[model samples]
Target: MTAQLANVAAVHADEPSMPGIVPATLARIKVELLGFIRNPQSLVFTVSLPLLLMLIFGSVFSGPVEGTDVDFRQVFISGIIAAGAMSTAFSGLTISVVIEREHGIIRRMASSPMPKSAYFIGKVLMVLITTVLEVALLLLVAVLLFQLDLPATAALWGTFIWVLLLGTAACTMAGFAYCALIPNAKSAAAVTTPPFMILQFISGVFYPFHMLPGWMQTIASVFPLAPMTRGFRHVFLPDTFKAVEAGGVWNLQGIVVTLVAWIILGTFLTAITFKWRGPRVR
Candidate 1:
């Protein structure tokens, strides 16, 4: 992706007087956005799946958390917000790329006269837009049905922003790297769904992290999603809720470190392994 962007930059440098680059980028973005919004499969992944999970979990656990005053509904809402972002940013993006590759859309785009960087930027922007909307929908539902309160302080909102942005970046890069694993678009769902579902269960999205066995918690901690959910909990839940977390404390430092590390690792892996050709062509 960086190489593609560099090629674009070189082209722009050579044609410094070109006045249509901005318009071209915007045109690409508009086209991609329209395609996404019109696709029912995209809507299911980006909108319905997360909202359904949020509704189910929030309704099922409609009480204060055991041994704490914090409401379980609130905890589920916070966790599901993170999970929704993962659904849209990581799983959603990965599967879309796989299908596009299978259908030769990516290959066609590569052969097009459009700037690769513009296409790449347009896709990334679409991911950001969809993920934000997914989170917003979850929050709106939580507020209306469960009466979730908005975070009041600057620090809380600041932490929420950091976690959301960092988590999205980490997950998006990781999704790109994951594309190398899908041998065909047919197997994309088979490969992607199990891991994401398992992560959600073990990483405290479906239950409290501490309830899992110590070894399982340790394993979950190695992944970005677990820390991402924890970060959300820290900002949204009361400080006392940390008592039940894996370390019995809010590990903001660990959250930041793990997410940043994953972002870098994912970027490196993506640059090395991402394939432009689909399985049939390869």
Candidate 2:
């Protein structure tokens, strides 16, 4: 299966781009955004999952972090938020790219005169909008359903947005890396979603990180998903919950290290492995 997919990719060699466009990046973003919003499944999962998780977990937990008085809902609020963003940014893009390749959209794209930078930027723009809307929807739910308050300090709010932006970028890069490695567009979900779901469970989205067994906590902390969720908790709540990972401060140091490292690793892997097409072409 792998060798067959590699040959298909080698055969296509060229992924086309749209030509004769006015502001191609902006145009492409609009097209992509329209397609995504029209997809009902995308709406439910990307936009609804965060809100749903916030409601359910907030009601179910009914209290603070195990070791501290800090509200677990307040802390896990960020985890759910991060998970939603990660899913949209990662699984969504990987699957989209795979579908585009299978359908000959990328082949059509490479044949066009539009620049590769423009095409890629357009995808990022769509991601940016989807992420912003998803965040807004989830935050509203967090406030009303989970009682998770937004950061009152300007500095924290700024940091929250920055962390979210960087975190989303990291997830997107990972998605691209998966896109590069996987052989068939048809298998994209088969390859991506199970791990994504499992990671959410282990990354402390469904439970507090420290509450998990020690070995599980260790494994989760090393993954980008856990770090991003923890960093986001710092941005959203009091410092107590982030203490689940590190003892004090906002732990900006830990967040910066984790996200930057994963972003770099995923980026390098993607560039080395990404293929534009399948060999079989069918």
Model 2 error, position 21 (Å): 10
Scanning candidate 1 in windows of ten residues, the lowest lDDT window is 15-24
Q: lDDT by residue for model 1 over 89-205, one digit each (tens)?
A: 788889988998888888877776666666656767777888888788888888899888878799899999899989988888889889999999889889998989999998888
Clashes of each: 0, 10
All models: lDDT? 0.84, 0.79
Q: Write the per-residue lDDT of candidate 2 for residues 87-109, one digit (tens) a residue.
A: 78898888888888777787777
Per-prediction TM-score to the true structure, in the order listed: 0.88, 0.86
- TM-score of the candidate numbered 1? 0.88
lDDT of 2: 0.79
